[model samples]
Target chain A: MKPNNPLKKEKIWRVAAVLFWLAAWQGGAMLLNDSLLLVPPARVLQRFFALVREKSFYSAVLFSLARNAGGFALGLAAGVLLAALAARARPVEYLLRPLMVAVKSIPVASFIILALVWLSGRRVSVFIVFLMVAPIVYGNLLAGIKSESVQLREMGEMYRVPWPDRVLYIELPQLKPHLMSALSLSLGLSWKSGVAAEIIGVPRGSMGYALYQAKLYLDTPSLYAWTLTVVLLSVLFERFVLWTVKRAYARLERL
Target chain B: MTRLIDICKAFDGKPVLEHVTLSLAPGVTCLMGVSGRGKTTLLRILTGLETPDSGTVEDRPGRIAVQFQEDRLVESLTVGRNLQLALGRAYDAGKAESCLASLGLPGCLQLTVSTLSGGMKRRVSLARALLYPAPLLVLDEPFQGLDADTRGAAIAAVRRGAEGRAALVVTHEAKDCELLGGRLITL
Candidate 1:
């Protein structure tokens, strides 16, 4: 018999739990006996496979992916720049306080609708994603900068470490965990709010439009399949981004 | 020569240093004081980390290497990178390796600082200060967590590295001053 490994055992338990949930979902669908109300997991998987075979599926996925990724990048850059400015100058922090608060407090749906008035339907999702992601990244990065070691800063100053070297060596290492957290949280919000904006705006060549169509025709399995696609895409993008960040840090550490 | 003329510093309405004057030149100086006697406050004033409320610092060099009371190293980075933060354009892989060896930490350039023991971290912090190319070196409690044997080695390394440059080391031990052949300044 193979040696009993704790990690392997944990994996087995996770698989079992997922299987149990699928079984419960299947049983509930059978009892309901209405595909329109609640589609079976198997049927959703089948529809998902069928959608994957369609050429339009790739276009929609690509369209949504591009907008979400672009918005996330813009938000990340703006947040970091704003946080740096805020950390440096008290006046900037004071100036940005109300703006960040407003962005955070506003509801995503309201922002999506407001964005629709200002932007084209295709561009609304991008704007909404940026709005959702910026404040989160800004807040976390500001906190990280605030919490950075005064002692380390003094050390840098005493050694006369250049600005670029100080950032690459001292600041970046200290900010990694905060940046990772900001990325993790904002990525999910970006995808969710992006898709919501898409559904509301009814943008063409987008996953949100496909979801809207599925809902219009009362095609429950198609809705479930599209939702699953969104979830998978969000998860995959997050993992990819986080993995790249970790690899970069690893290489930096090796130096 | 660098001079602090009649320096006075207070924190939260309590005086840490009061009208204290001192001068530093190209030699080792051990600053000894009892707890709460402002030995570190003096170092901070000299290194320009803290400004004295009523005094002037004359001829202070723009670059002074410092080993802080705490390790203050980037925990996720390797020993080499931590040193590189201080050494900057002056960093040399071979010199860094040899410096670590002299500080009794041989072949530890690739080891992450978080994995090191407290004493090892202290030595790395000291090594960074000693390796930095600066006119002055300020070490605050540089020998805090080491055993007697390691402490002796660290002191010897400091002695060797402080040649042709000014060093102000803070400690409570008179023997440390004797070992470094440094003039003792008691606060």
Candidate 2:
């Protein structure tokens, strides 16, 4: 007989809990007898399966995925560069303080509306995601760089250790935890605000457009299915990005 | 050999080291004093980490090695990597292995610094300074976490490393001076 595994047993219970919830939802929908108010889980799943088979579904997924990924990459690059600059120079920090604070404090919706006037609908999500994520990365990484030990830095300087080696051996490891935390928080915000922008802009071939169309026709099952798709994609993307980051950190340690 | 003439340093209007003049010449020089007496401040001024209010450091070496009060090892790096970082282009894996072995940390090259005991970390810090090729060595509380036997061994290792070179050490224990076979200057 196969050995009993606690982790496998735990996963079994999680699946059972999800099934119980689905059954409860189906029961509630039956009691109401109104598909418009609350669609049954079975119907939502069926619609989701159907939606996945369509070519437009793929198009919508790819369109929004591309914009969001583009924005995330751009924001990560710019944030890391700016944070490095600001950490080293007091004048740079003072110059960027007001702009970073403004970016952080401004509402996502206001930015979306303002961006709509200057950019095309397709680029709106990209701009909003960039705006949402850059400040988080900048603030967290700046704090990480500042948290480096002055004593260690002095030790490096006295030893005449090269600047690149100091950064690789001293600063990067110190920044790892802060960078991981910032990425975790910003990745979710990237998707949430990106989707929100897409919905407002009504980009022609995007997931947000599908969500809007489902609501316009009062197709509750399709709406639920589209929402589920967005959630799944977001989770997959997050897991992929985090796994990549973990691998990179492992490599750094090995080096 | 390095020399400091009338080095004076202060923090927030309170003097830490006042008009202190000393020289390190081809042997170990141990600085001993009570807490807050500026023994460390003097070492810092010699290492160029801090500027004296009114003093000049003479014969400053082109290259210097130092072990701070804290271990200052990158916690994520292995023992060998820490030494390599300090030594830079002069790093040699075989030399590092032998150095660690001499410090009672054999085969520790593969282990991350965080996994080491406090005494082990202190030894690693000392080993890094010893292995680096420099004319001058500044060691601050190098035996802080070691037992009597380990402290003796570290002192011997330091003496071996400091042969034909100048070393400045700061410690609370007067016994360290005798163990290191060096002169002690009480602040």
List the candidate 1 regions with Cα displacement exceeding 4 Å: A1-4
Query: How high is the DockQ of candidate 1?
Result: 0.80
**Per-residue lDDT tens digits of candidate 1, residues A1-255?**
763998998998999999999999999999999999989999999999999999999999999999999999988889999999999998999999999999999888998888888899999988888888888899999999999989888878877789987888889889999999999999989999999999999998999999999999998999999999999999999999999999998887777
Query: How many clashes in each structure?
Result: 0, 0
| Candidate 2 chain A, poorest ten consecutive residues by summed lDDT | A1-10
Candidate 2 residue runs with Cα over 4 Å from true position: A1-24
Candidate 2, residues A27-63: lDDT per residue as tens digits? 9999999999999888989999999999999999999
Candidate 1 similarity to native, TM-score: 0.96
RMSD of each: 1.6, 2.3
DockQ for every prediction shown: 0.80, 0.79
With candidate 2 superimposed using the best TM-score fit, by how many Å does residue A53's alpha carbon deviate from the native?
Answer: 1.1
